[model samples]
Target: MNDPKLTPQALWHCALGLLSRRDHSRLELSQKLRQRQFDVELIEQALDKLEQQQWLSDHRFAVVQVRQHIFKKHGPLRIRMELKRKGVNEAYIEQALAEEDPDWFELALVCYQSRFRNRDIPDIKEKAKRMRYLQSRGFNSDQIRYALEAEQD
Candidate 1:
């Protein structure tokens, strides 16, 4: 249970402990603090202090998340959705994505080839299945089509 006498310093220390483990967007930190039964005003004050001290930033979190997702070979669509879910704003998401200039089409091709290199594409059904797999991996329709066509060439 939350003590009615919980001080702002206590709440800030709790927030710092969470931040020490991993980066968190402001909203995510607020939600976690709230779950611990901290008062809303106290949580806001703690978050403001963290932001002021430059120890918390949604922009930094988005950048790190985007890089990690790209390394995992997840596509832009999936990455964007994940960032949105993490309470990152559109500006930060776009800025983070813009900083990385990978060729998505080629990336999609590489991802497809890596997964389907040994398989035989024998029929329309099989090709369609492969296309669906690529789509599920977050490649856009153009990127999927290009990757499939590249396989035929």
Candidate 2:
């Protein structure tokens, strides 16, 4: 690692290279640069440059993150909190989440069925277990309940 005191440009280049490989939230990119001992001011400048060039965008980050995380079987609540932790703005998160259709509950149920196929547990116990699993994945209580009941029907 170049000395933080002497190589701001090198640090920026390195960070940009890393970022070019994937989308990174501001906080995430900051933490990565910090681990290399880059000065905070220098890191911020690099990040600002990237943003000005449109190479870094929180809006794009939020959209891609939500899409990718949901595809991995994560629930919306979990995805939302994770995006917040990654430093995505609240307004963007809310807007993206709002645009998502409410019919996702049925999709979630389908996912659960696919994953747990071929095993038949008793209804009450099964619903409880399913609820816990979905809740841990970040679904709200209502969504989880609805999915569980729909499974029974």
Candidate 3:
């Protein structure tokens, strides 16, 4: 419904309501507005206004998300994938990943200790389990092995 009567003000209000709760990519906002049947032009106008005011920023979103993900022990690969899914630009994702410096080995060891504190297993089984766990959390094999080796030391 590209109703000219559907004012930009209404769309802006709706968009602000959504943004107030959490960060969203422009693509995500566009899709939501489309489902609401707002006029495409009106929605785009509102989005442009928001961007002009710095209320809608893909770079800021990427930075915040990457920081939080790393803090929660997520690896760069997983964080990058998530940012891409959220429609962040490739250059922004690359910059954000480069800016983040996490101690994967330490974090992985901590995670391993937390998950298998009292458990005992053979070296092979333990390594396998650790590999699976870290990999599932989006860590590369190298990081996982380093962490596991650190645990063994």
Those runs of model 2 whose alpha carbons end farther than 4 Å from true positions after fitting are 1-6, 99-102
Between candidates 1 and 2, the TM-score winner: 1
Span of 10 residues, lowest total lDDT, candidate 1: 1-10
lDDT of 2 by residue, 44-80 (tens): 9999999999888888888888878777777888888
Candidate 1 per-residue lDDT over residues 1-153, each given as its tens digit? 257446777788889999999999998999999888788998988888899998999999999999988887778888899999989999999999999867889988898888897556799999999889888877899999998888888
lDDT of each: 0.88, 0.79, 0.80
Error of 2 at 26 (Å): 0.6
Local error of candidate 3 at residue 14 (angstroms): 0.7
By TM-score, the best candidate is 1
TM-score of each: 0.90, 0.88, 0.85
Backbone atom clashes (below 3 Å) for every candidate: 0, 0, 0
Order candidates by lDDT, high to low: 1, 3, 2
Candidate 3 Cα deviation (angstroms), residue 101? 1.9
Error of 3 at 143 (Å): 0.4
lDDT of 3 by residue, 1-153 (tens): 356545676788889988998888887888888887888888888889888999998888888898988778887778888988888999988887777766776776676677777545577876687789888777888888777777666
Candidate order by decreasing TM-score? 1, 2, 3
State in Å the error of residue 35, model 1: 1.5
